[model samples]
Target: MIPQKLEVLEQTEHKLVLVIEGISLEMINALRRIMLTEVPVMAIDEVIILKNDSPLYDEIISHRLGLIPLKTDLDVYKLPQECECGGFGCPLCQVSLTCEVSNATNAPLMIYSRDLKSNDPKINPVDPNIPIVKIDKNDKVIIEAYAILGLAKEHAKWQAVSNVAYRHYPLVEFDESSLKNPELNSLIVKMCPEKLFTMSNNNTLKLKDDYWRYCTLCMSCKNNSEGKITVSPKEDVYIFSIESDGVLEFKALLGQLFKIFNEKIDEFITNLEDLEIES
Candidate 1:
């Protein structure tokens, strides 16, 4: 098979969209699964509650902490299971975060993930606004959290990508000559939920390309058009989109995913060679 061609349509720190050609759906789905489940990220793994005067139990607070997305540096850290410390605990595998709060005001004070102090400067909560718990006036809360490098397969908190999906590119065909009738044009425009159809100055139906991506393939336009319009999917090309969970940049996540893919391919080739040698 020929190699697939990947053309990046849009990219940002948190989101990416690409057009991939010459690839099968099964191969693309495997990459999506790996990005969602195999990507390594940092998240709170252990909690040591020193004090708790709030209504929430220690386990509840710990769960909240674990869900918070932490900044990850793959180059500087190692997965806990792979660390040389034997998984007991080490600076290379874990980070310590401490949160201490004593509400002195009359109003209820909200504790947020930003309140947690991390021993490592590089690993911290991605969103400071994530509320951990609410404490009434004169209440106190203290806790120690241990953040660790892990894979998303172990827990959702470690998932690097928030979403990964792909779909066939949309193809819309409209017979403008047949849509010259004002009544038919009005009907077509009215049937489109996305408002994709509009009337041109020449009194013919016009389709907007901007709304094509949001097409639901409901066949309303095709059904109402009476052979004036048709919609289909471009089977050979796919529109792919990915969303990051803030632990790693979208580009960084893609780089790591490609690295993993190459490694897996090499390992498969090596195993095949070994099997042939044995035969």
Candidate 2:
């Protein structure tokens, strides 16, 4: 069995960075790929326009609505194909959101995502500021849309995360005595783009203890120090980062990631046993 270690370097509502150790490069890359395209999220797929007094065409308005990211509840909803309703419209597979806006004031009124009302109180747009259209005085706009769980591999609207990537774990090695030139040390300290270096009390170059969290392994320090320093990536370790649009919380996203990973692994093993290949 392969040993693995996971550590969180940084986490926020919409961003996460992790230190993944003891995993092969191929496995880590596969995880990144799955996170980008396989994770499921809720997005508007169908739109009905009953009346449109806005300047934009019906197609443009529908397209904009389709791109709006919606908060997803995996426990409450299932992918349409996987639902018991067999891809037919049902509460377990889809949610309806409707917007009805009329401008009675003299000035043009803007319609935002907040105007849309969802049948399910739990599911709503990730951001309320996303503009759908604008209506002039005495004009009205009405729309009905359906949100469903889907995969990014089929459409980008269903993508749960963005900026999903991993980089090699970085290691910087050097001896203070070897970096004798004060000017070189100062240059090295200042040259680091991530500010992972500093000057020590002894007036020599000092590296940050948690440099791996921010280092891009650019080799700038090694080059600036001439032959005094060396920079390299550690084997079987990676720094993984993910950015989200508030579709899924960090805990849920990671949970779904490993779930898909294990499912694929189990499927592969079962299929392997059925193969009749002879060596």
TM-scores, each model vs. reference: 0.90, 0.94
* Residues 37-134 of candidate 2: C-alpha lDDT, one tens digit per residue: 99999999999999999999999999999999899999889999999999998999999999999999999999999999999988999999998898
Candidate 1, residues 1-279, lDDT tens digits: the string is 243788888878788998888877787887898899988999999999999999999999999999999999998888978899989889888899999999999999999999999999889999989999999999999999999888889889899989999888778898788778887788888988988888977888888866557776777889988865778886767788998868998767878998888888899999988785743
Which residue pairs overlap in candidate 2's backbone? none
Model 2 has an lDDT value of 0.91
C-alpha RMSD of each candidate structure in angstroms = 2.4, 1.7
Q: Which portions of model 2 miss their true places by more than 4 Å?
A: 1-3, 200-202
Error of 2 at 155 (Å): 0.6
